[model samples]
Target: MTSLSKGDKAPEFHGLNQNNETISLETFKGKKIILYFYPKDNTPGCTAESCNLNDNYQAWLAKGYEVVGVSPDSVASHKKFADKFQFGFNLIADTEKEILQAYGVWGEKSMYGKKYMGVMRTTFVINESGIIEDIFEKVDTKNHTDQIIKALDIK
Candidate 1:
């Protein structure tokens, strides 16, 4: 799969959120979207990343941005995770791997000599006009909010 680049146009996607509400990329037009894809829900890295974003979510909105987390987990799983963590944003359930494949965030991952297919902890910042403004592939979930804020040029 071709890795998504800085200028690559983010693929369009229509999926259900934790509430089972159908959402499409078009619905978020004219807004800054922080699209972060993680491997799973409730896991250490994923939890830390989501919590950090939740912790600093106001800063992002003040800069005219919205966040939409995506993962291969089911909507129920996403709901439990979000409810448990008190997240303030939508979690797109990409269980079919459609969005994951299109974004190139889903692929082979290695852990202790075992290879498995999963999300790569990649994030893309899409501008209001739908162009990808930046990408952070080397995500450190513990300090991800700072990284995203810096990438978006927010003070």
Candidate 2:
């Protein structure tokens, strides 16, 4: 679990998006950010979560929020995934796990009696000034937007 909590200063990060464009916290300095970290690209849970956010892209934008995804997947994989889903948001390719480590989302995991290091699916809702407003450690993949909206009481 992440040591980060609401009201803490969000860690600054910079990574390449699917388009290979450099993006950083500074890029969205004046906007609320929904920063999500997932395990991989094209996986079932990740896909569902990503698509849910994509489907509500317009609503998020209208609500003054920007969605960004981060995964250990490479830039090429992110490009393919985003292109296939036609996502309007940015998917950061954190191939080096720099951003993941900064957010404390990259860590050990156990599945089927096997232990491995991987991403812990998590989301951070950061306010305009780079303060974390909410942290979602247990995400509802298929209905994530609703989860965030309900948690934040967004009208």
Candidate 3:
């Protein structure tokens, strides 16, 4: 799997959000971006991670940051997930896997010794200029917001 690192340019991506509205990297330009890739919608780990971000979303916004979650789910699924959880940010539907592959989060993963290609739980901290500031390959689902806050050294 190709790994993106700090100082690298975040890949440009555009897709439909939970509301079926077009969202792209350009939409978040000039703002710090929390671009997280999850395995699926409504899953246990994913739910926890999303809720944590939701809980701390206002703080992020106040600091000029925006949180966006990406997965290969459909727009309808994303809508339901957001509505159920009251997520404060956008959930991008990467149904074509283009954004996932571009970010290098789509790769081989093993579950119970069965290896397969799927989305990896990853988060990218991108600066206002679209340069990657940090990469979280091993995300702590339960405390993901804390992880980001710590990584970015947000006060």
User: What tens digits encode model 2's per-residue C-alpha lDDT throughout 1-155?
Assistant: 89899999999999999999999999999999999999999999999999999999999999999999999999999999999999999999998899999999999999999999999999999999999999999999999999999999999
Please give the TM-score that candidate 3 achieves against the real structure. 0.97
Decreasing lDDT order of the candidates: 2, 3, 1
lDDT of 3 by residue, 7-99 (tens): 999999999999999999999889999999998999999999999999999988998889999999999999999999999899999999999
Residue 17's lDDT within candidate 2 is: 97
- Show pairs that collide, candidate 1: none
Q: Which candidate do you rate higher for lDDT, 1 or 2?
A: 2
46 Cα displacement, candidate 2 (Å): 0.4
> What are the per-residue Cα lDDT tens digits for candidate 1 across 60-142?
88988899999999999999999999998889999999999998888888999999988888889998888888888899899
Candidates ranked by TM-score: 2, 3, 1
lDDT of 2 at 72: 92
Candidate 3 clashes between residue pairs 3 or more apart in a chain or in different chains: none
lDDT of 2 at 126: 100
Q: After superposition, how far is residue 95 of candidate 1 from its true place, in Å?
A: 0.6
Model 2 residue runs over 4 Å out of place are none
What overall lDDT, based on C-alpha atoms, would model 1 receive against the true structure? 0.89
Error of 2 at 19 (Å): 0.4
